[model samples]
Target chain A: MAIFYILLLFIITAAIIAVETKNLLSAVICVGAIGFGASLMFLFLRAPDIAITQIVVEVLGLIILIRVCISRELTFISGPREFFAVVVSVVIIFAIFLAGIKVLETLPAFGTPIFAEVPDAASQTYVEEGLRKTGAANLVASVILDFRAYDTLGEATVLFTAIIGATVILRKKTKKLLEEPDV
Target chain B: MKGMTIIVKIISGWVKVLIFLFGIYIILFGHLTPGGGFAGGVILASCYVLLMLAFGREFVEENLPLPLASKLDCVGALAFAVIAILGLVLGGSFFINFLYQKYLPGEALNLISAGTIPLSNLAIGLKVATSLFLVILVLSMFRPDMSGDKKE
Candidate 1:
C-alpha cells in the first residue's frame, strides 16, 4: 500500500538524520524512531511476534543509549570531509533505493508462504502436523521448542555467557580487593 | 539519584503489577499464542526497569537483589540443559517430547499440552528476564552523574 511506502520512507529519513545529527540525544531519538518504524513494518508483514520483540528491544536499547550519552564525558570534532562523505553516502543510498524499488515486485508475494509453494517441506510438515505431533497449538512454538529444542538450548547458553561476560567486565571492585595488591 | 516525581512513581507502581502478569501470561500461553519466551521475558524485565527508573536503584535492588538475579539466571539456563538431558535419558533422543509421548498428554489446545515446550518457555523466560535485568542494573551503576547522590 501507499502507506507502507510512506512508512519506509520515514524510516529511511530518520536513519539519515540519526547518522548526521550532532546532538547525541537527538540522534538516539531518531534511531529509536527508525526502530519503531521497522517494528511497524513487521506488523504489516503479519509477524506480531517479531514486532513485539523489536519494540521492546528498541525501548530498552534507547533507554541504555540515552542514559550512557547523558552521563558520559563526551567531545565531538568534525570537519568538512565528514559533511562531503555524508552527502555522498546519502545520494548513493537514495540511488540504490530508487533502483531497488522496481526489483521488489520480483520477490515473493505476501501471505503466500514457502510452505504453500513447496510440498513435503520441513515447515509444511510443522504446519500440518505440529498440533498433533507436539501437542502445541502454536506451530511456531512447537517447532522451536519441540522439533528444534537443541537450537533453543544453544540460544540459552549464549545468553548465559553474554550475561556472565557483562557481569564480570562491569563488576565493581570491593573495598577489600582494592586494599590488597597481589605481587 | 532520587526518583522522578511522585506522579510517575505512583503510576509506575500501579502499572508494574499488570506488566508482570502480562509477561507471565505471554510465556504461559506461548503454545497457543503469538508471544513466547523472549518477548515475554523482555516485557518482564522492562517491568523491573520501570521500577528502577521510578524508585531509584537502591530501592529496586533491595526488592530484587543482584545476587539472586544472577543465581536465577544460572538456574534458568541450567534448567534448559537439564530438560534436554532428561529427554535423551527418557526418550532415547535429545530434546524429544518425552512428556507428550508418555506422561501428561493433555487434550489439544489446552494449557497443559505441549509436553516440553511449555517447560522450555518457562525456562527461557526466566533466563532472559533475569539476564536483561542484570545487564541494566549493572549498567545503571556506571552512571557517573548519580554517584554524588549515593553518599546521601
Candidate 2:
C-alpha cells in the first residue's frame, strides 16, 4: 500500500516535469512514462484488461506525439497560455481526485462479485440461452457483435468518416505540393 | 548511410521478430486474453514504424508500397462488411454469428470457439494495420518547400 502511494507520487512528479519541460521530445517521453506508470497502477488495482488497453492506446498516442514533435511547425512556445493551461488542468485533476475518493468511500461493498446484483431476467437469459438461440459460442461476443450489432456498425461508420476527413486534409496538402515547381 | 552499426542492425532484426510474434499472439488469443483486434493491429504497425526508424522509410516503402497498403485497407473493410451481411441474410441480426454451431465445435470458453468474432478481429487488425501504414508513409513522403511557402 505504501509502495503504491510512493509510485503514485513518483508518477505525479514525472507528469509535472513532463508538463513543465521545454524540449518537446523529452516531454513526450516523460508523458509516455507517466502513462505506463498509470497502467501499472491499473494492473495493481486488479484490472489487467484496463491496463492492457491503456498501454496499447498510450503507446499509439506517444507515437503520434513523436511524429508531431518532428514537424518544424511545432517548435514555437507560448508561455502565458501554457501556464494557464497547467493551472486549469491541476485544478480539474484535484477536483476529480477528491470527488472520486468521496464516491469510493460511499459505495456499498458487495462481499460477493458485483455482478451478483444483476437480477436473472433479460441479461441473464441473454447470456445463458443466447448460444442456443443465436448459435454463437461466446455470449459476450454475441452480445457485442450480434445483439448490439447496430452500435458496431455505427462505430465503423464513424471511423470511416474520420478517415475521409483525414484524407481530405492530406489531399489538399498534396495539391499544394504539386502546384509548386522548383526553380 | 555510413552511420550504420552492427548492433543497430541486430537489434532491429530482433525487434522485428518480436513484434511479429507478439502481434500474432495478441490477435489469435484475443478471445481469451486482454488484447483485441485494435491492440494487435497497432502493435503490428508499430513494428513497421520501428523498422523505418532503425533502417529507413525507403526499406519499408519499397517492401510495402502505398498503393498496396491502401488496397489492403479497402479489402479488409469489405471483408468485415461481407461477414456481417452474411449473418443478416441468414435472417439473423447484422454481425450476428448465426452459423457457428454447424461448422465450429468447441467449448464457449475456448479461444477458437468464438467463430466470427475471431474473423472480425482479423479483419479489424488488417484494416487498422494497412490504414496506419499508409498514413505514416504519406506523411513521411511529404517534403514541404520553404521557398514556395515564403512566396505565398
Candidate 3:
C-alpha cells in the first residue's frame, strides 16, 4: 500500500515532466504511461471501479491531446528555470494533500462493516434474480444496465455529446479541398 | 530504409503478440477476472501502436481501413443498445439480466455463467478497438512529414 503511494507520486512527477517537456510526442506517450501508473495505484487501493474509470477517461484525454498535437503541429517548448517549476509543482502537491486529508477526515470509512448497514435491497434482488431474470455474470453490470439503466443511458448520451463536440472541434478545413479546383 | 538489428525486430513482434493475446484473454475471462471490455479494448488497440512503431503509420492504415473501422464501431455500439432493447421487449427493464438468470448455472465464479457479461465484453472490445484505432489513424495522418531529415 505504501509502495502504491510511492508509485503514484512517481507517476505524478513523470506527468509533470511530460507536460513541461519540449517534445509533444514524448509528452503524449508519457501522459499515457502516467495514466497507467495511476490506474495501478487505484487497483492497489482496492478501488477497481475508480481504476477503470480513470483508465478509460485518461486514455480518451490522451487521444484527444495527441490528435490536437498532430493537427496543430503543437510541440511543447520548455520554459523558465527548473527550480521554479519544481517549487510550483511541490506547492500544488502539498496544497492538494492538505485538501485531501481534510476531506478524508470528514468522510466515514467507506469499506468498513459499518457502511454495509445500508441495506442494498435493490442490489440484492438483482443478485437473486439476475441469472434467471437477466443472465449477467457480474452483478454490477446488471445493476448498471438493468436496475439503474436510466443513469447509464444518460451517461451514454453524455459520451455521445462529447463525441459530437470533439468531431465539431476536429472537423477538417474543407475549403482547402474545395479550393484546389478538380485535381 | 536502414536495416534494423534482429533483436529490435524480434522484440517488437513479441510485444505486439503478447499484448494481443493478453487482451483477448482478458475479454474472454472478463466476467471472472479483474479486467473487462474496456480494458481488453485498450489492450487490443495497443497492438496497433506497436505496429505503428515497428512498421509506421502506413502499415496501420493499410491494415485497418478507416471506413470499415468506423462501421465496426457503430455495429458494436448498436449491439450494446439492442441487448437492452431485447430486455425491454421481454417485459424486463432496459438492459435487464433476464437472459443471465435463465441461462447461467452453478456458482458466482463460474465461467459458463454471467449471461450477457461476455456479450457486453465482446461488444465493448469491438467498440474500443475500432474507436481507438480510428483516433490513432486520424491523428497519424496529420503528423508532420519528416522524411528528409538526416540521421541524428
Candidate 4:
C-alpha cells in the first residue's frame, strides 16, 4: 500500500511537471512518465494486461505528440478558459459513463462495488462459469471475446473511425485542389 | 526524414525481430497469457515505429505502403465481424462459441482450445496493428501550411 501511494505521488509529480514545463517536448515526456507510473501501479494491482496496454499506449501517444512538437514552431498554448472548459467536458463525460454504469445491466459490475451486497449477478456468472463455458485459461480474454463481444466490435469500430478521420485530415492534396486558389 | 545514427540503426535492426516475435507470441497466447489483442497489437505497431525511427519514414513507407496497410486494417475488421456473424447464423446467437461444443471440443487450457477467442484476438490484433501504423504514418506525413489552407 505504501508503494502504491509512492507510485501515486510520482504520478502526481510528473503531472505537475508536465503542466508546468515550458518546453513542449519536456511536457510530452513528462506525460509519458506519468503513464509509465500508472502502468506500474496497475502491475502492483495484479492486472498485467492493463499494465502492458498502458505502457504501449504511452509509447504510441508519446511518439505522435513528439512528432507534432518536432520541427514545428511551438505557439500552441492553452489559456485558463480552455483548460476550464476541458475540465468541465471531462467531468461531464465521466458523469455520463457513471450514469451508464449505474443504469445498464449489460455492463460488468463488481461484487465489492455494492459493499458485498448481493454479489453482483453478472460478474458472479462470469467467475463461476466463464472458464467452463469459454475454455480459455485467461478469463479476461474469454470475457472480452465471448460474453461481451459486441463491446469489442464497438471498440474496433471506434478505432477504425479514428484512423479514417486522421487519414482524411492529413492526406496529401491532389493537383486540382492545390492548383485552385485557396478558398 | 533522415534516420538515426549507426548505433541506433544496428541495435534496432537486431532488436526489431525479437520485438515482432514477442508481439506475435502475445497475440497467439492471449487466451493462455496476460496480454490479448490490444496489447499485442500495440507492441507490433511499436516494432514498426522502431523501424521508422531507425531506417527513416521514406524507407518504411516504401515497404508497407499506405494503401496496403489500409486494406489490411479493413480486412482485419471484416474478419472479426464475419466471425461474429457466423456464430449468429450457425449457432443461433450473436458471438456464440459454436466451436467450443463441436469441432473444437477438447481439454481446457490448451493453446487451440479457446474456441473463437484466439481467432478474435488474431483479427483484433491485425486490426489494431495496422490501424495504429496507418494513423502514425499519416500523422507523420502531416506538414501544416504545405499546399493546403495557409494558417498564416
> DockQ scores for all the models shown?
0.57, 0.34, 0.23, 0.59
**Chain B only, TM-score of each candidate:** 0.94, 0.86, 0.84, 0.92
lDDT of 1 by residue, B1-152 (tens): 58899999999989999999999999999889888999999999999999999999989988888778878888998888899899999989988999999998989998998788999999999999999998898888766535655546
Which residue pairs does candidate 2 place in steric collision? Answer: none
The TM-scores of chain A alone, one per candidate, are 0.74, 0.60, 0.62, 0.74
Which parts of model 2 have CA positions greater than 4 angstroms off? A1-11, A71-76, A81-115, A118-151, A173-183, B1-6, B109-111, B143-152
- Deviation from native of the Cα of residue A1 in model 3, angstroms: 5.6
Models sorted by DockQ, best on top: 4, 1, 2, 3
* Residue-level lDDT tens digits of model 2 in A1-183: 776887799799989989788888888899998999999988887766567667876877787778777746655455655778879998999999999999987766634444456787567777678776544454544565556767666666676666556666667556532232332
- What are the lDDT figures for the candidates, one per model? 0.86, 0.71, 0.67, 0.86
Model 1: residues >4 Å from true position, as ranges?
Answer: A73-77, A80-112, A172-183, B145-152
Native interface contact recovery, all models: 0.84, 0.23, 0.23, 0.84
TM-score of each: 0.86, 0.75, 0.69, 0.84
Which residue pairs show backbone clashes in model 1? none
Model 3 C-alpha lDDT per residue in residues B1-152, reported as the tens digit of each score:
32245676678877887878988887777766567777777778777766775676666767876667767877978888887787778736667665665544445667666666677778777777767766665555444433222223
Candidate 3's C-alpha runs over 4 A off are A1-37, A48-104, A109-114, A117-168, A173-183, B1-10, B103-107, B145-152
Report the lDDT tens digits of candidate 2 across residue range B126-149: 887777766666665553533357
For model 4 the local lDDT of residue B108 reads 86
Relative to the true structure, candidate 4 reaches a TM of 0.84
Compute the lDDT for candidate 1.
Answer: 0.86
lDDT of 2 at A65: 77
